[model samples]
Target: MKMNNVIFIMGVSGCGKTTIGKLLSEELSLPFFDADDFHSVANIKKMSEGKPLNDTDREGWLKIINKLAIDQSLKKGCVIACSALKEHYRFILSTKLETNAKWVYLSGSFEDVYNQISERKNHFMPSELLQSQFEILEVPANAIEVSITNSPLEIIKIIKKQYMKSEFGLFGLGVMGKSLTRNLANNGFKISMFNRHVAGVSENVAVNFKNEHDELSNTLAFDNIEAFVNSLQTPRKIMLMVNAGKVTDYVIEDLLPYLSEGDTLIDGGNSNYKKTKERSAYLKSKNIYFIGTGVSGGEEGALKGPSIMPGGSKETYESIAPFLNAIAAKDKNNLPCCTYIGPDGSGHFVKMVHNGIEYAEMQLLAEVYVILKELGNIPDEIADILESWKASASSYLLEITIDILRKKEGDDWLVNKIMDKAGNKGTGNWTTIATAELGVSSSLIASALFARYTSFYKEERVQLNKLYDKQTQTPKITVAEVFETYQFARIVNHYQGIKLIAEASKAFEWHINLSEMARIWTNGCIIRSTFMEELVEILKETDNILTNSVIVDQTKSLKPSANKVIAQCALAELPIVCMSESVNFFNGLTTADSSANIIQAQRDYFGSHTYQRLDDESGAFYHTEWINE
Candidate 1:
């Protein structure tokens, strides 16, 4: 590997390029070359006469250096000290090299370089020519930029840390893939990108990404899967950000031939956890590692940083933790909002629940907006109220909601002009199904999903609006009461969602840490909020949060406000389905007694289904022989 690690230390004269190059050559046990030695007699004499060397004079000098770089790179790798000041010069020097020549730019102020030049004991380059070199220098964005502020040893350490033999590979150059690729490159990780081309598209997304980010030295694009796989270092790490299901499976199968044992394949999409589990097991049988990673936050978050949840073998996660954590969102404490969730589908499972809670929260917010608007508050006034709510219940969604409320197109509010229909991409439904499978109550999330479905009946709703003639006054509800109601609903929504997750943890044997999950959701993800931070602390105190005395006390105090808000919305003939269902769920779960006993008797009498009596042993079933009156 060292034989293929060709390095170029580049800067203006007096920036210590030659010194650093020699040191690097010795450190890495490679031969060193100074571009000055490759200069022609005429070029050397011209510099000896204290004259500035122009592009014409430097052309031959660059060719010689290029050949040396190519030749040495093919052999036992070499370090070259070159003042490759211009981008064109660097290009010429690297054009023929099969592998990228790692260019390290030693950056410093003109004053600093001049001072060093003035103090030089003996050199062909004159101090007077230093100014011209500085003037003509074109900084390479593709090169690693190292400041001269640190000692030579420190600078060498920086360069060594920045340069890695093999880079990460990404498949699928879609929006999420492109954004994540850029994010990784920005963090100084070399990334190899490949996209399966489809006809009719004028430009290839992978090609466009390469062209747009040409200045990023660490990013490489490939059209062939074979070459892309081969370009990655041994024990290769590749992430698939393609469509879920069969497409993901197809990509894995295609790449499997090229991948060796211990290499990892990460699925960073919204794949079904069951599919993820199957893939992980399959890959394990082949001696390759599979990670089912859940990446939250959308395109913008991908470009910046997102909360990352990686689930697979603990050893596999450890191998990729450095890259994952380096590119993950940081909280207020500067900790990455990422962690190893568990084995198999735990990461994706957590993400599914995150989306589920996102659905409920959005529905709750929409209900609040509708209630306030029905109460005759203008968009601007509602925006103001939402802005104030930030202090009490701060979240990324809330901030965006406020901005959305304030937006206007000409004389009309954009929200008012938009269609009433809502859309989802299946994660919400997935959560609903998972909860049902676990026999967990997730009425708030289920109600939210149904709300979107009901919204799709646009024609029916319009006709119903025209036919219905019932008139009613808007129920009086204070803004404070409405706010209190929203807060309460949010708690209930999160509570039910968390309960579902807890049940899943037990059923799946994931042993998920609820507090840690809450902490990870406090940033980057769509459902991130100040509320989650508080919830994390609360969960640490007790595992059964629903039955925790502190939460129970809070719920008791907030119940009246929720009831009032629900009553007013109902009186005003507005639907608060999620909130109403959440209240119902809470009531049903907390109630000590109910009418289910009579229903149980009916079932026993009709079908001979056994029912447990209150006075009987808990596990014992009894059949009653009763006569119907």
Candidate 2:
């Protein structure tokens, strides 16, 4: 009842704005201001003489009312009666009070409004000019619409009910879902949460979450599908945080029947981009809105703020932008780390590439840990050394690696006690396959994925270790060289991942902005880093990172360090799969005259495949027998 919202009752003249505004004003215990009182004497005189005010005439009056609304919004808030007939007029009145303003549209037929105006006593807006007001009325898409046929008291009740409906609905109660819901509620959004109740497992999950977070008074939880759907306002926005793949499909089918036209559904899981595109089409066929948003930063980020990538209809995106932006992480410049990706599936595709880069980055760091360990550096010493690089090479991966190294179980290093095998959740595999399909090389990401697959052979590795003894010698590499190699390898890894995304964006006609991707990743995602911050600026000039002069100069300086690290690791019988592949990929990519000519000749000799000659600047192909009998 004590809501801090600047409520505006808008409609054509004689639509009961003043009548309901006064009743609601008393109900909410807020000051009521009529727009007529703020109008200039000349404006009232013109209107009284049966002439309507033009846009220019009303501009200053709207500004005066907006100033009053702004001041009241900062205080307890107020109710205002205004004929905000045009969309721009509403926009002018609500400027600087976006989040705190709520609109109630008093809709009525011509006959109803005409009758009310005929009975009016001393209003300056004459009955003859009522038709002019209706002609210029631009109905709002983001307001609570109520019929003026209802009595003023009944109208007040409807307004209150619609105004108090939950602003957003989140339909999953898992770790990430719960965290995000709490984050929304913390940001002053009334949210409804729905988690289906199973017989034994997850029974009353939604209810229990609400009970546990008793401090979040703006949240509601439900186990019934219809009840949950009905709890939201019109054109409801619901985000699903369930598992990707079939489980996501199942949840969509379950909610489809309850969703109305114009309602928006967001898949906030790690769903495949292809699936997201299909879902977008499927939902569009039914007049429902769908957005495939890629949310990163894991559980902690969900509780605080994660980077958000939403792609679907840009129109529908605007309807939910306020809520998404409120809960998204901020970059160095204090901009929200959420943006509209090109269209359906682009957001998920970006997230998939993010995970691919994550795989390579983690592998690169792990290789650094092994090389440092082989160089007789203890866990604590390595942690300190890596922590010292935060000024220039800070990253979420490096920060966590430092924590992981220094974490001890009593007197022993805990990381040593953990299993060597790494697990993947299919995104890296998808990235590798996509690169091959797109004819783009992402060797660093592939090597990282292969390293995880190879680590799964625990028994085979044990037997091989015994059968073929590695006469391993300690590498004569300094910690500084290893750090430099790590930096160079990370640059190559990011380049490869982004190149894959750029290729896909071209192939799919997504028209994605590569620089914006870097900007968003600069803060909340796992791959966020000081390097990503640099990339935000670097990519603005050129989409190809290799073509950028600064990166090229840095690569020139760091290539020798990478080569030295790889050479010593190879001689010492150490495996640096991702780092070594990064250098190899770079070399292959930069080479203009590759040995593929020999490959072409071999293919032609065996399969009679024709070859193009280097001298053939003209468009021509040639074939000749090397051995003439």
Candidate 3:
């Protein structure tokens, strides 16, 4: 009963494609589709007139077929008889179908196909046009090649015999890996799950997972790396969900021996972007495709749907887009939260910035919580207030914070019992480093990361508090003022984060579509929100968020409250690192005339560096001395 979700009976005209496809569909109890039925009237006319259609002509037709295949892939498998002649045409037809699509090429001599077409009574494809198809035919090497001379029944039998391999392969059966595997299986993609057998650690990890999920009849599990690789269909798509660094490399090295030239390897970890670039180049030399994809949302998101950011060769991305999209979270418009970011490492870089923004957002929430606590509101009341802000400022982070604040263990607040120290898993650090390296302004992200580092010195902070006799008067800040401050800081956080991404795109020639990135972040990501939905529109208007009228008006209205909160927090001896930096970054960015002239003068006086003169029409550079040595 093992079968591809989409069986494409492909060949030039008059190759028994329809005959074989219909027979196969009946045998598999699947629906059948003819590519000709979906063609536009203009296309039919062009072909009927014996004129060959160009790539541009077939582009829309191919996309329509691809969409049909993707839709059918989520339901019962379908059999499609298509003249998927050129390699690029086949690629387009299989866009979202990925490994779930299998090709059955009807092979025959040109003369034989021509004779069969000449004998046909009624068909839109004329025998005269058959020669053009043959001329454009880029035969697929990975198809189940059956001679057109064979009976339809015999060809179906051969196809059934060869289509037993799983649609996709997943290596690493840890938390994220296992969740993704189940997600793929649930989406009707036959998947092979693999995990190295480590005694006492992960013995029979994949095998046990398969046994536990008996309903996942489409899956095969293996502790043997060779067996796992062999279980996948050709142009094998294997995603590595292991740890980012040495573990990912070691697993890749082990799998390399078994992988072929056309196979693709995906890293679904928070690996450093530079490392991703290195691995991508290395794999390209080996003739293997490497994709560095960022899978956001935690365990629940993985099992349900996560926002997927995949970057690699555009061609390579097409081979795996369907499988990723099928398991990606849907936005309000029901579009998958996945897109082809760009070439090598860009996905990871976007994800790194995403995590950095996540840090700032989380710290913003924490600061709000502390301010509320200082103003004499308990955890429960604070949670309710935050819950009320959902209509305007709702986000995944905010939702989770509300739950965490409301959580109690035996009448004692669990959050209160927890330590004040915060922990980060390197992505936030990587974000700050990338921002600095790219010379982008990311003070909010940097301040958030530094706050975490400072929190690590819990003992030092406690000791210093006593030495300084740390005490604070309650800040005269209303909930409305605090909420406004939160809104303003969040707007600035997103602006800075997007700016960093925009700068990196310019510096590295990534050419990332900020609008698409915003769309993907509208769901399944930690920073997803109503604000992201608005941002999706704003980014489409301009790259600089501050310039948008919506952002400008909102910031203008919220600026007074943000200023008051910062001033009062400082006077009350309370720390608001991320919020303070957010306001400061905004102030610095908006300043038309800056005091940097003094710094430039100081540098010129000491180091003899040149400075550009604002008064000079020709933009002349000059250096001056101040004090006589």
Candidate 4:
């Protein structure tokens, strides 16, 4: 299984083998070879007859691949392309290699490969024999399987990570790992990783680890857990992101003794909140530093630096923030991808609630999309509508939606081909638990998460089709003009949500920055808005304005249009209705309680302690009508 100095770019002929392999070799600074250029006259003649290649015909080809591997092992790196059609052929060549090497499997489905084959005229292999190639094909569990669907440049970008390193010992190494490592190395962070298996890591990674070079490079290796830990520069800060719960416990139990007192452990996984708190306390009892950071942004976001919500000691979180921020995605103002949410389980708790909001926002967006696509029958210009809406009521989510409409998935559009099914993790469930404990309500986020859960029941939905009509009642509008109104509404909802968070901060005594939080989230995390820069400046000009109504009163001119976003979301068919509902929920606090009248009545009834009111010069509450006169 140790590839001895042989990098094979294996796929059927039409898979950009020659072109991509050449680029890969140049990028990795390796030699290049192609198996297509090695075909014998007899083999070409038999394959031109539409006959399938057998094990006998492949032996010579496999020998050539082995020779190429041995020859390239003497040099630094090499890229060789071959129709490594069978498990046995790959097995023979890997066993015969002189020094360790890698294998990049350029792969696609049979239908896709056959289509490419059919287009070629001068190729020795006929299209009729495509099935036989698939029949012989066996995907090695260890091989780096590069999908053929992406363009050569995208593939090349992924491959560029092959020569980079990840820092601070982190999560999954597939898309997330590669992207994180590449970005961090690009930003100058030395990283070490632990993996259950070693196949995916390359020789460059192994060399980087051994040499202890100062500047970042793709210094990595897949090793046994114990060995991997031993290889690290000590007083280690290991960040684990395997599955949550029991696996976390298992890894912790195993790693406890090996780590010293100054060493730290950060759980970057989505573990339960209570569990994280308990685990942190437990680690502290053992004199170990424990941190729980909540990471969001899917694979792309993770690797590209996600919005990280870290909670632990004031010490440990601060220690890691520099590296974490360096790799995280920027907000609108291009700040780091993270914030210190607070102490104890605050980071995970915020993350759980953040995910809850994510669920609601996504569900709301989906509902609107359905309303537009199914009900409005809007055509190819979905991007334009999304763009117009963003002029005022803008979010990164909406901006991405606009851009997504422009993407093509082969002959069909990506937005068009997507199924109604959505995915949900358990964060919404966690939010429900937390909200119940804290005596608060968040119906919108909860509803959105539940909506995704319901997406799985297509069978039930189909059965329900008999009972109810799918037709939706929709209000028509000139979308371009309505966006101006919607933009105002979005800004209102955003500020309201923010104010609610500020209220929570005050009630719970977290003392979070309303403005800095906005600035920190300007680039990397979800919910980024273009207004964050101005919002931060507003905070700088008048601190605590969100909590101060005198300043809020000063915004009377902006209030009418600002409050209209909620009104619009309600009247219009957009999802901001939930957002609008929150506004009503929050602003409704000033309703007529008449507590002053009641208090005065109580005072008069009890001991004659008076109350002052309109048209009163002195402080007094009238005991009787005659007394008032």
**What would the TM-scores of all predictions be?**
0.75, 0.91, 0.88, 0.58
TM-score of 2: 0.91
lDDT of 3 by residue, 110-141 (tens): 98898787888778788887777888898775
Error of 4 at 575 (Å): 8.8
**Model 4: per-residue lDDT, tens digit, 153-203?**
888776555423232565344445455555665564456665454465433
Instruction: Report the candidate with higher lDDT, 1 versus 3.
Output: 3
- lDDT, candidate 2, residue 166? 82
RMSD in angstroms, all models? 15.5, 3.2, 4.2, 22.9
What is the lDDT of every predicted structure here?
0.85, 0.90, 0.90, 0.63
Candidate 2 displacement at residue 482 in angstroms: 1.0
The parts of candidate 3 lying over 4 Å away from their true place are: 1-6, 14-80, 86-102, 105-131, 134-158, 627-629
Q: Candidate 1, which segments miss by more than 4 Å at Cα? A: 1-165, 470-472
Instruction: Give the winner by lDDT: 2 or 4.
Output: 2
Cα lDDT tens digits, model 1, 531-583, are 88888888887656767786788778888988888887788888989888877
How much does candidate 1 score in TM-score?
A: 0.75
Q: What is the alpha-carbon lDDT of model 3 when measured against the actual structure?
A: 0.90
